[model samples]
Target: MFIDGRGHITLANRMCDDIFQADTSEWLEHLYYDCIHDHNFVLFIQYVFLTETHAHEQLYFDDGWSVKHYEAYGTPVTNSKSQLHGVVVVLHDITGVKRLEEIRKDFVANVSHELKTPVTSLKGFAETLLNESMENQDVQRQFLEIIWKESDRLQDLVGDLLELSRIETHNFQLNLQPIDLSKIGAETERLLRKKADDKSLQFNVSSEGNKEMIGDAARIKQILLNLLTNAIAYTGEGGEVELNIYEEAEFIVCRVSDTGIGIEKQDLPRVFERFYRVDKARSRDLGGTGLGLAIVKHLLEAHEGTIEAKSKPNVGTMFTICFPKEWSGW
Candidate 1:
């Protein structure tokens, strides 16, 4: 966009029309303030004209649906005598870059906070045992047990972080092959049945149709393990947990449902986010690193699969995952 010496929009391009959500063709020769609805952009142009120099700023425009970020640069257009003619403004989209920066910051903060809790506990308990002379062996054993538990939690957190990082890397690829979902479901059930039984939860696995698909067997098992483990962990004593695998169209679907302490409506969407927990205290007590769901989501994405979660607080939660019957990796 170009504004004339009299602050009139002498020229405007289609890009300007898009950024401001207006018709630049009709805006040509109109006053900048009259045509441009974004006050910050208009002020940027005015500042460049007033200063008769280059100016730059980061600005955002909301087009009702969503907000978009842009890096705005304004340079004064002048004659050979250094007399101002107009100001030329350019906007470069930086929404993706800004979003990545935000994600990076949030990831770092979450990892640090998660690591700090266990590390603090380990240090405190170890210090108590080393610095203080304890007479009761039982009390000493209790401190040692807490230190060991914190160390185990820290190890789990680190392992999950590494697994998530590996799955998220650009070069990550699934070891796709012909696999049977029924077999995987059975194996996962056997692996976690003991935990469910310990809690007296009723656990079951059933399959119908053809449960065969082309994907990474190990990652598929990981996905099932994460979901099933969460079900057992969150459910109360004698609650029911079910794993149903079946074929749907060209996809193999696995649905894990549990009569557990369900997630609230508002928190359901973010349940897959790293370190997100509906019951932080209970999840920590259950030895959950909080990255299980995140890992499941990433592994599903790697296999070009999809997952859907539904729940009602104090009732139950169900997670349904679908994997394509055939996959040609990109």
Candidate 2:
């Protein structure tokens, strides 16, 4: 905005017309104080006009739908003799950058908390085993087992975090190729069937038509394994978990449903967030790092795939995944 010798708003672009949602002609005649109510911005305008000082500031404003961030730079208008006239302000939007910064902060905080729990447990168990538990074979074995489990938890957390970071980075791309959904489901069942059997939960896999798709096989299998493992972990004895492969229109689909302690409606939207757990204590007890779904989400995005989850409390959860039969990375 332009001003005379006085600190009044003389002119503004369409974007700068923040306070007075009016015509340019009307806004140019209004003073800066009349247009903006923010104390810092008003003070900055006054200071720049009076002292002819150059300034830069980052500010936020609410436009009707949402809040937006802006970076404003002020430069003085001066005569040939270097006498101050008024200040000209330029604004740049930086909302997206600010959002990424917030996401990064949240990610770091979550990872720290996730690592600390298992690390503390491993430390405690090792100390016990080295001291009092050393003479007691049963106690020592139990403590050692706990230590091993905690170590595995830590390793899985680290591995998932790294994979998520890789998948989220701008440079990452999927190694897409034709893959068989049925084979992946079969392998996942084979790897996790023992766990299901241990809990007396019935595990089954069925497929038809080969269920071919183009995507990263390893990432796809990882997603299925995560889902299957979670199913086995959460399902009670005598419950059933099924992995089905089929074709839906032009897409190959993999559906895994389990009769388990399902998620609540309120928690559905945020289920894929890092370190978010419906049951924190139970998740930790089950050795869940809480990054499984988050990793699944990122990997799916890389492959241009989609996943849908439907659940009802105490009933069960069903995860339906779809990938294009032959994506050209278009």
Candidate 3:
């Protein structure tokens, strides 16, 4: 955009329409202050005109529904006399870059916090045992148990972080192949049934329709394990957990449901976000790294599949995942 010496918008480009969400053509001949409402942008232009030099700023424009980030550069237009004629401004969209930056920062912070918790516990307990040399064997054993548990939790957290990182990489690909959902469901049931039994929860798995599909068998099992484990962890004694495998149209569907502490309406959408827990304290107590659902979502995306989560607080939660019956690696 070009602002004249009188502060009027003398020229504007098509991109200005998109960046400012207004008709740039209509802005021509109008005063910059009248056309551009963003105070920071106005200030940036004014600074360039006042200093008769180049300036740049990162600005954000909010349009009620969403916010957009922009890198704006303003430079004074002048002739050989070095007298400023006007100010020319340009805006470059950087919303995606800004979002990635925010995500990276959040991820780093979360990883740091998660790692610190277990390390702190392990260090404190180990230090106490080393410094005190308690004569009571039970107290020593208790401290050792805590140290061991924290170490195990730390290992799990690291493993999950690595897995999530691998899945999120640009070059990541699924080991796609022909697989059977029913067999996978049966296997997962066998592996986790003991856990459910420990809580006296009624666990069941039923299959119908055609369960054969093309996917990464290991990842499919991982997805099931994550969902089933979460269901079991959140459910109480005498609660029920069910895994139903069937087909819908050209997709094979697996629905895992449990009478667990369900998520709130506002939190359901973010259940798949990394390190997000509906019950943070209880999830930590249950030895969850909070990356299961995030991994599940990424794995599903790799397979060109989808997962939907529905829940009613204090009633139950259900996850329905669908995989294409056939895949050509496209």
Candidate 4:
């Protein structure tokens, strides 16, 4: 912002338009106070005029869609004789920094909450084994088993958190090679068959045809395992989990479907967020760290691929992943 001898806008930058998402044509003919709506900012500019000195301050507002943060610097323009004639204000965009601060706060809160339950369970079970159940071998064994499982869950959660931190970094890289996704799918199916059979679930995998593609085979297998494990875990007895791989145009598509309890419509968009669980209690019972889908998402991005989901309550959910025939890592 720039005001002239009459305190009217004379040299307003294009940022005036960018900040409001509108044209600043009318701003040219109006007095500075009349043109600017933020009273705090206007008052600061007035302070610069009243004191004939420079001032700096921060301001923020929401334009309905999103909140914007700004730090403004105001200066008084004076003549050769030191007569104050005008004021100039410059605004710095600080929304990204504010957002990062918010994300950091949320991450700390979420990690604390995620670890609390398992840690409490471990403590309680250990206490019972030592103080209350020492004379009873059967009860001691049960408490010890619970302690072991909770410890395992803690380990898995830590491992996933580290892996996700690595994957989310801007410089993360994949060791790409020519590998057949069909083979990976077969191996994942074999690995998870027992898990599905334990609940009498029907597990099936079919490849339209064997096709070799350039990708990190281990990561691809990780993707399949996470998806398959999630499906089988959520599914009930006698449910069906199906996996299919095929080609369409220049993309290789992998589709996994489950006949189990489905995600609510409102939860679909956030299903890929780290530590998000559609059914928290059920997920804990199934030994999930709530990072499986989040991992799947980041791994797919590393492969220059996309993933999407569709589901209905009580019907089931299907996950579709598409990989471009050729990708140049950015």
Most TM-score-accurate candidate: 2
Per-residue lDDT of candidate 1, residues 1-330 (tens digit): 888899888887778777877678888888989888888888888889888889999999998898899999999899999888898898999999999999999989989988999999899988889999999999999999998888988988998999998997888888877888899999999999899999999999999999877788999999999999999999999999999998888888999999999999999998898889878888889998679999999999888899999998889999999887776554
Error of 4 at 4 (Å): 5.9
> For model 4, how does the per-residue alpha-carbon lDDT over 251-303 read when each residue is reduced to its tens digit?
99999999999899999999999889988888889998689999999999889
Q: Which residues of candidate 1, in runs, are more than 4 Å off?
A: 21-43, 61-68, 80-83, 328-330
* Per-prediction TM-score to the true structure, in the order listed: 0.84, 0.91, 0.87, 0.86
Candidate 1 lDDT (Cα, 0 to 1): 0.90
Per-residue lDDT, model 3, residue 321, is 92
- For model 4, state the Cα shift of residue 297 in Å: 1.5
Per model, state how many residue pairs clash: 0, 0, 0, 0
Candidate 4 deviant stretches above 4 angstroms: 3-10, 18-35, 47-54, 63-66, 78-85, 128-133, 327-330
Please provide, for model 3 over 275-327, each residue's C-alpha lDDT reduced to its tens digit, 9 standing for 90 to 100.
99878998899998789999999998888889999999999999999887766
**Per-residue lDDT for 1-330 in model 2, tens only?**
787666677778786555334565665667778767667777777777766789888977675788778787888999999987778877788989999999889988888888888889888888777676367788788888888888888888889888888887898877777777788888888899789889999898999786776777888999999888888888889999999888877788889899999999999878898888999998888888788998888888777788899998889999998887667676
213: Cα error in model 2, Å: 2.9
Ranking by lDDT: 3, 1, 4, 2
**Least well predicted 10-residue stretch by lDDT in candidate 4:** 127-136
In the predicted model 2, the residue pairs found to clash are none
Off by over 4 Å in 2: 18-25, 62-66, 130-134, 326-330
The lDDT of each candidate is 0.90, 0.83, 0.91, 0.89
Identify the superior model by lDDT, candidate 1 or candidate 2.
1
Candidate 1, residue 178: lDDT: 81
Q: Which wins on lDDT, candidate 1 or candidate 3? A: 3
